[model samples]
Target: MKYEVVIGLEIHLELQTCSKLFCSCSTTFGKEPNTNCCPICLGLPGSLPAFNRRAIELAVTAALVLNSNVQLKSRFDRKNYFYPDLPKAYQISQYDQPLAKGGYLRIETDGNYRNIKLERVHLEEEAGKLIHSGESIIGSDYSLVDYNRAGIPLLEIVTAPDITCGREARLFLEDLRSILLYSGASDCRMEEGSLRCDANISLRPSGSDKLGTKAEVKNMNSFRSVELALNFEARRQAEILVAGGTITQETRHWDEEKKLTIPLRSKEGSSDYRYFPEPDLLPLILEDNLIKEISAALPELPAARRERLKEQFGLDSSEAALFTVNRSLGDFFEEAAGKYSDYKNLAKWVQGDLLYYLRESGKTVEEVDPQQFIELLALLDAGEINRPVAKDLLNEMILKGTSPQIMVQKKGLGRISGDEQLLPLVEKVIDENPGAVENYRQGKDKAIAFLVGRVLARSGGRADPGEVNQILKEKISRG
Candidate 1:
């Protein structure tokens, strides 16, 4: 019997705030371990917790962007757990009354769009990291706990189990990340552990309405790994069911390097993490006007902006889609292209030249130097270099941060556009390549390739092949 995969995602995004949720400590990443922890974050006795108002505003702003219903009354609950990572031994999270509910995010895939119903988007505090040199959370070594990440405000977005396939789930995540970046709520940098995902997946018979035993997969740091982990789990579960073996409901570990899921523990009861309302904090009451204010502040999201870019810039669907995937990347393209009349060439240069250099240099588009990119585009417009030479110069700029003009000078990549400078090279190539010249006169039309090669070799590949080809045809035809 064929099996169908059902998947749901729980995405956790660390809010981009100046301070932690319950204290005034820095929430910035990359600080020295435990340097940013405060009394409230460290759970010192007699320290009172105050909710960060800015954190609430950011969370509400994100909820509005997702079209969620902003709740008038929301409360924080203490989720009790004892771990080295969680400094308080309890995570202050939203349990019953969340900030938003009943929102739906529209995700597009393969020219079709679908909605993933939101269960809730709740506010919570992040745990820190435990770096151990041993295996299985045990064995020989003592672990170092970094409490800097603890108490950082996080938004947990839980979705209904409506996803049907791994590919659809991946698209949902991409769109979700786009929305997060566009909203400016979070950077959504998965590699930095700012944005994380946990997927719950199960497989059932194709025609059955009943849900089967599901497994939760976590520790996937990238979109590619999420899809891969889900796919592997679904296949593994289906094979077990087909062979009449029972699949266990458990929480599994996603071994990213191994590209497989390993059983972590049985998913049965939550006995230890006793959750209760914290006596120290009061209920958060979200006002209607406050919600309205944030709702009004919401910008044109990815899909709407994509449509606008396609229509306003005269770009195709695919071009617009490519540009809008990353907000900063798309902003750079428009910042460069919108000023000029020929956005088509700008699009081509960005996707072809800009994207190529980013790959070659192993850098992100955000890490690119906008001034150098603008200079390269300006050179292409000013006829300082031809297409291939411009590409070489761009590669040099990316690899060495060398100025494009410097590359042109040092590598002799300047175009020979002027006939005065190009004619001597053209004439010399014609005289020496007699067989090719003879072939050109004898109507072996493809011999133009040979003449072009001779001219380029003499010019150290600096001559514009287009001009050389044109100059050669004319020189060979002279009476």
Candidate 2:
């Protein structure tokens, strides 16, 4: 019997706030261990927690972006648990009264768009990081805890089990990250641990509505890892079911290097947390006026931007999607588009050559001047320099931040467009290659292309290809 894989993701995003969620401690990353902690963050005696107002605003903004309905009165609750990373012995999080709920995000996969419904977007504090000296946490002889990440504000986005496969899961996360970055809510940097994901997946018989025993897979640091881990877990569960064995519901860790999921422990249910409403903090009351302000302040999201790039700029869906994934790159393209007349050529340079140079030189779009890039495109348009020279000049400009025109003049990289200078070289190429000339005369049109390449080779890539082709066609036809 064939089976279908079901996946749901619990994404944790650390909000871009200056301070901790319920304390005055710094939220800066890469600090000395425990250096950013304070009395409240460290959970010392006689300390009380105070919520950060900025965190609330950013959270509400994110909810609005995701189309979630923000609750007017949401309260915090104590999630009772005992762990080494939790200094408070219980974490302050939202239980029954979350900040937002009933939202969905659309993802395009397999040439079809589908909406992945969101379960909830709640507020919580991050736990500390655990450092293990040995290969694995279970094998470590000693461990260390860094509380710098503790008490940091985190937004938990829980999604429904609507994803049918691993590829869909990866697409959803990519789109979600783009949305988060566009909103300025979080950086969503997976390497820095600012954004993390844990997937719950199961495999049931095809066309069955009953959910199978699912496993929660953790330690997936990247998007690729999430997809691979879910695939492995789904296959493992399917094999067990096919062999008439039961799949135990447990929490598993994705061993990325080994490409397998190792069982961590039994999965915990809601009753295990022993949750209750916190007494220290009052219920969060969002005014209607504030919601309206946030909604109005929302920028054009990724989906809308993609569509606009396609319709307004004449970019295909793939090109538009590629440009809009990085907000800085998209802004650069838009700024250049305002000045350049050729929209398709501008898109090609930005998406193709500009992106390639940026990656190779270890630079960003901000490092290059838009005016300088526009000047380069203008030079190409005017036939002042050929494409090869323009590409080399672009690389130089990206590396040294020099002017494209100045470099072209200094290096003598101007295109040999004048027919007076190029006619002799075109004549030389035609005289030396009699076989190609004969082939062109005999109706083999591709032979003239060979003669043009010879003329360009003799000109050191400085000759205008269009002029060479025109001159060669005229001379070959005359012969």
lDDT values for all models: 0.85, 0.92
Per-residue error for 196 in candidate 1, Å, reads: 1.4
Off by over 4 Å in 2: 423-454, 469-479
- lDDT per residue (tens digit) for residues 94-122 in model 2: 99999998799988877788999999999
Q: Positional deviation of 463 in candidate 2, in angstroms?
A: 1.1
> Whose lDDT is greatest here?
2
Model 1 vs. true fold: TM = 0.90
* Model 1 CA lDDT for position 378: 80
Residue pairs with colliding backbones in model 2 are none
In angstroms, how far off is 121's CA in candidate 2? 1.0
Q: Which stretches of candidate 1 lie over 4 Å from their true place?
A: 135-140, 268-272, 362-384, 396-420, 460-479
lDDT of 1: 0.85
